[model samples]
Target: MDARLAPFATTPRLVVKIGSSLLVEGGAIRQTWLASVVADIAACRADGQQVVVVSSGAIALGARRLKLGKGGRGSLDDAQAAAAVGQIALARAWAELFAGHGIEAAQILLTLGDLEDRRRYLNVAATLDRLLALGAVPILNENDSVATQEIRFGDNDRLAARSGQAAGAGAVILLSDIDGLYTANPCEPGATLIPTVARIDDVAHMADGRSASGLGTGGMAAKIAAARIAVQAGMPLAIVDGRRDHPLTAFAKTGHGTVFTAESCTSARKAWLAGRLTVAGRLTIDAGAAAALATGKSLLAAGVVSVDGDFARGDAVEIAHAGSVIARGLTAYDAPDARAIAGARSDAQAAILGYAPRAAMVHRDQLVMV
Candidate 1:
C-alpha cells in the first residue's frame, strides 16, 4: 500500500458523503458526532484542500421531529414528507456547525435533472466552483422532497460520486457505518476486510445479497456502484467507518479504509456525459465521421449518414458508425431537423433545413469522446 495514497495522508480535493446511519443515533441527530465531522472539515480547509459534503439524514431527522411513526421503512409519501420537513433542520444543523468554526456553509439541493441536463449540469458546476473559490463549504443533498421515482439520484452514494466528478475532486470518501468492505459478511466466520480494491467490479462479486443496516438505505451494492462511477471518472474513493473517533482525520492520516483506485481520468464535461444513464436518440455517422471523432473533431452534418429516434435540441444522443457507437453528445438540433440536414455540407445546412441551428450536428464541446 502506498502510504501517501491513504485517505488522510495526502492532500487532494475530496468529496465526503456521510450516511444517515452515521449522522443519527436512536432516531435523532447526534450533535457530538456532527461536531467532530465539522472539525475535520475545518482541518481539511486549513490545509488548503477543497471539500464538498453529500449528506443523508433529512428524512430520518424529519421523521423523528414530526413524530411520524418509529423506525423501519416508510411509504414514499412518508419519505417525501419527512424530507420536506427535515431538509430545513438538516441545513440549520450544518450551518450552525460550520458557524462555530467561523466557516460558511452553503446548502445545494439537487435532483437527477440537475445532473442529466447539460445546461443545468454546467450551472451547478459553476456554482460549486464559485463557492469553493470563496472558501465556503458546499453541503449537497438530493432534493427528495420534489424528486419522483423517474428523476432521483436514488441514493447519496451515487450523488457523492457525481459530485466528485462535477468538482474535479481527486478523491471521494464514503463515511459509512462499517469500517470497510469485507470478503464476506464480517459477522460470518472466515470473513476478512479487503483494504484495497484496484477495480470495483471485483468487490461487487463479494457483495452478493448483502443489505445495509436498518439505519441506512444504501448497502454494499450502492457503495460499489458509487466506486465504479468515481473510478471511471479518475477519482479514487475510500469507504471507511464513520463511528470511529476523528474518522475523517484518521482516514486522511493513516489511509485505513477500503480504497478503490481510479481507472482513467476524464474532463468534467466528458465525465458528465459518460455518467449519463440514458440517451434520448442516436446519430449514425459515416466512416469518415468516425475517423474525425477518433481524432477529436466536431461532427459536421455533412459527415452524418442518418439520424434515429426523436430527440430535441440539448437531448443526449449516441453517435455511431456501422451500428457501433463511437461517441455520445447533446444534440444541436431535433430529430426531424437533423434528418433533413444529414449528408448535406455544412454550408448547405441553411439551404436544406431552411435555417439550421448549428452547422455541426454535434459540436466538439457537446460531444463526449468514447
Candidate 2:
C-alpha cells in the first residue's frame, strides 16, 4: 500500500478506465471479473459517489463474434466492422450487470473531435452531469465504428483522462494487467514497481514500451500519457493491477498501485469554459431569460428574442438582454434555424424546423453568465 494514497476515499466523482485485457479473456467476456468490478461501482454509489466508466474491448468482442483470426484485423474497415458488432454486446453486458444492482447504464460513444471542440466538449460535459444526476452510470467508449484514422483515438487511456476532465471527476483509475509503473519490465529480473509518482516527467523514462495484448491497443506508454492528462486536470490517477477480482475494492483497501498526484487544480467549470471558448454569434434574450440565467436555469427558446450572426450548431454564442451582454454559451442550432425557432415554445421546435434537435437554444450547462 502507498502512504500517499490516503485521499482515495474522499473522491466525490470517479472515472474508471477498464482495459481490454481486463474485460476479455480467451476471446470472450470475463463475466466474473466484471461482476466484481460492478460491485465496486455499486459500493461507490452507495457511499454517494458518482461513477463513470471509460471502457475498451468492443473490437475484440466483435472480432470474436465474427470469428476473425486473433492476431490482428487487416485494415481499418475490418476493425470498424468488428467494433460495430461488438459495441452492442459490450453495452448489453454492462446493462445486464448494472441492472442487478438497480442501476441504469447509459451508453455514450465519442470521437476525438468531441473533446477538442469547445462547444461539443461542453455538451458532453453537460450530458455526463445529467446522467449522474439521474442516477445512471455513463458507459463511454470511442465511436470506433464510424471513426476514421484521422479522428480515431487508438487507446481508451487518453479518453479516460478526458472523461474525467469533462465530468470534473475527482479521481481517475486505470485498471491494467500491471499494477504500477515499473523501473523496468517486470517480466525481467531486478525490475521493481514504483509506488508513487510525484512528477510524471521525472519518471517518464521508466516507461518500458511493453507489447500490448492482441485485444488492446494501449501499452504502459499510453497509461503514462493518461496520467499526465489527469494530473494536469486536478485529479489523482492510479494504475492498478486489475487481473484479479474485486480490483477497485482491493485498491481501496491496499492502495498498492502507483498514485500520481495532481500538479494543479482545475478551475470552476463555467470559468474554464468562459476562458477557453470564442463566441461565434449573439442571441438577444428577453428579461425572462435574463432572470432565468440568474437563477441557474437553462435558457429556453421562448426566452430568446433574436439571433445575430451566422453560426452553425455547436458554436459558441453570446446572450444579450436589454442591449447588454448577459452570458455566453454554445448554441444547439445553426443561426438560421435559431431564427426560425426563437421565442417559440420548446414543443414547437419540431414543427418550426424540419427536425427538432434539442429544446434549449443553448443548454444551461454550456452557458455561463457574464
Candidate 3:
C-alpha cells in the first residue's frame, strides 16, 4: 500500500458509502453483491474494526415497486412516496444481509439538518457511537421520504460525508460506479487515473465528467463535493469502483483508486476549531482535567470546575484553565445541563441528565489545543 494511503488501511473505524447504482439494479436490491460486502464487513469487525454503511437506494427500490423508470418519479411527491416505500425494503435487506454473518444491522435515517444543527448533531453522534460500541453495523441513509428539497442534502455523497463526521469515523469510502478521478473521462484518449488527491481544488475541474457506467446520479461533481466535506474534517476519502463484486475486499487489499488524502486537514481542523467558530461559552477545568486535555483527551463533565455563558449543545465553547484559554470545541450539552453536571461523576451522569449516553463536554476529535 502507498504510504499516503496508509490511514485508509489502518483506520480503526471506517464509513463505507454505497451508491444507489451499486446497491440496486433496475429497482431491485443487488443481493449477491451486498452479501459479499457484508461478509467483508464481518471480517473487518472480527478484526476489531468498527464499520458504518451509508447507503442510497430507497427511491430506486420504491420506483421498482411503483413501476417507475430508473430516474424515479418526476415530481418530489412521487420521489418521496417511492422513498417511503423503499426505505422499509432497504432496511430489511441490510438487516438480513448482516444477519447472515451474525451481525446485527441498525438502521439510522437522517436529514441534512440532523448533521447541520449542533444539538441534533450531538444526538446523532451519540447514537452512532453507541451502536458501534455495541458491535452492530449501522446502516445509515438519508430520510428522503420526509426531507424537503430545501433541507435535503441533494445526494447521498454529501450525506455520507456528514455521517462520517457524526460517527467520528477515521476515514470514508465512496463506492461508486467509476473507479476514481481521472485526468479526463476514461472514455477519451490520454485519460489516466490520479491516485492521490492532496488538495480537492487542483483537480476539481474533472467534476464536470459524467459517470462512466451511466448508472449513478451523483456523477464526479457530487463525489468532489463529498471529498471537500471529508477532507475539511480531516478524513481521508476514497472513491473506488463498486460495481464489481466484493469491492471492499479488493479495496482493503490494494486500494486501487483515487484517494483524497487531505493530509493537512488534521492540523487545519484544529486551526479551524481554535479560531473559526465564535465562542458561545467558556468552561473552567481543574488541574487534572487540564492535564488530560493537554494529553489530547476529551473534556468530561467530571473534570469541569465551572461553566460560563448560556450556550446550546452545539455551540462552540472555550476551555479555560488558570485564567487562560487552553482549548476550544463544540459542546455536547446545553448550558443548564452542563452547569448541573459540572464536577458530576461519570456513573451518576445519567441520573443527573435523565438521559442515556451523555457524551463528553467536548470530544477529543473536535477539541483543539491552543
Candidate 4:
C-alpha cells in the first residue's frame, strides 16, 4: 500500500481517469475489471465522496463494431463514424456496470472548445455539480464523433485534469498500464520507478513517448503533462498501475504509483475564473451592489446600474462600481436581458425578462475579486 494515497480517503471529490487499455482488451470491454472499478466508486460514495469518471474507450469499442483498426480508419470521417456507433455502447456499458450498485450514470461528451470557452465551461461545470448533487456519477468523454483534429483531446489524460478542474475535484487519479513515473523508461535496463514527483522539470527528461497499448494514446509523457495541469490548480494527481482486477480494492496494499504534489494551493474553479478566462463583457453596478459584493454576496439585478458590451448567458463579465472594476463573474443573463433588468427588483425580474429568470446577475461562488 502506498502511504501517499492517504489523501484519497479524505478527498471530498475525486476525478478518476480510466484509459482505453484499462477498460478494453482485445476488442472487448474488460467487464470484470470494470466491475471492480464500480466497487471502488460505490465505496467512495459510501464514504460521502463525489466521483466523476473521465473514461476513454469509445473509439476502441466503436472500431470493433465498424471493423476498423488504426490502419483501417484512415480518415477523420471514418473515425467519427466509428465513435458515433461506439459512444452508445460505451455509455450503455457504464450504465449497466453501475446498475447493480443502485447508481445512475450520466453521460457527458465534450469537445476541446467546451472547456476552452468560458461560457461552455460554466455550463459543463454546472451540469457536473447538479449530477453529483443528485447522487449520479458523471461519465465524461471526448465527443469523438464530432471532434475534428483541431478540437480533439487526442487522449483522456489532459481531459481528465480539465474535467477535474471543472468539477472542482479534490484530487485526480490516472489508472494506467504502468504503475508510475520511472527514472527512465521501464523497458530500459536499470530503470527504476520514481514514487513521488514534487516537480515536473526535475523529471522532464524521464518522459518516454507513446502508449504501450494499441487501445490507448497517452503515455508517460502525457501523464507528466497531466500532472502539471492538475497540480497548478492545487490538487494532487496519482498515476497508478491498473492492469490487475480489483485494483482499487487493493490500492492500500499496493504501493505502485507516482504521486505528484501540487505546487499551488488555489481552488481549481477559482483559479480558472481568476486567470484563464477572457472577460467578455462588463457590468457597472451601483454602490449598494459593490457593498454587497464585498461581503461575498451575489450580485443582484437591482444593484446593477448599467450593462456594457454584448455577451450571452454564462459569459464571464467584469463587475464595476464607480468606474472601478471590483469583481468578475459569469453573468446569469445575456446583455440585453441584463440591461432590461437593471435596477429591477427580483419581484419584477420575470416581467422584465419575459421569463421566470435566474436570480442573481452573478453568483458569488463564481465571482472573484480583482
Q: Pick the candidate with the highest TM-score.
A: 1
Q: For model 3, how does the per-residue alpha-carbon lDDT over 1-370 read when each residue is reduced to its tens digit?
A: 6786677667888999998888888779989999898888888788778999998889888987887664564778878888999999999999998888888999999986777666787799899999999989999988889888778787778788778877878889999888999998788999999989988779888877355444445789988888877777778899998878889888877778999985444554463454232477999999999999989899999999999999998778999999998888889999999999999988988898888636698999889875
C-alpha lDDT of candidate 1 relative to the true structure: 0.83
Q: Of 1 and 3, which scores higher on TM-score?
A: 1
Runs with alpha carbons beyond 4 Å of true place in candidate 4:
1-3, 71-73, 267-270, 273-370
Query: Which is the better candidate, 1 or 4, if ranked by lDDT?
Result: 4
Candidate 4: tens digits of C-alpha lDDT, residues 212-276 = 88667788888877787788777789998889977666665675688998766665556676533
- lDDT of every model, 2 decimals: 0.83, 0.84, 0.83, 0.84
**Residue 104 displacement (Å), model 2:** 0.4
**Runs of candidate 2 exceeding 4 Å displacement:** 1-3, 208-211, 268-370
Candidate 2 residue pairs in clash (backbone atoms < 3 Å): none
List the candidates' TM-scores in order: 0.80, 0.72, 0.72, 0.73
**Alpha-carbon RMSD to native, per candidate:** 4.0, 11.2, 10.1, 8.9
What digit string (tens of lDDT, one per residue) describes model 2 on residues 129-185?
Answer: 999999999999999999888786778888898888899888899999889988887
> Lowest-scoring 10 consecutive residues by lDDT in candidate 3?
268-277
The better-scoring model by lDDT among 1 and 2 is 2
- Residue-by-residue lDDT tens digits, candidate 1, 1-370: 4653644445457899999988877667899989999999999888878899999998888888777774424777877888898889999999999999999999999999898887887888889989999988999999888888889877898889988877777889999988889988888999988888996656687764244656556878888888877887888888998887679878766767798887777677777887775688999888998999888898998888888898899888999888777688988898999999899887777888776458578888888765
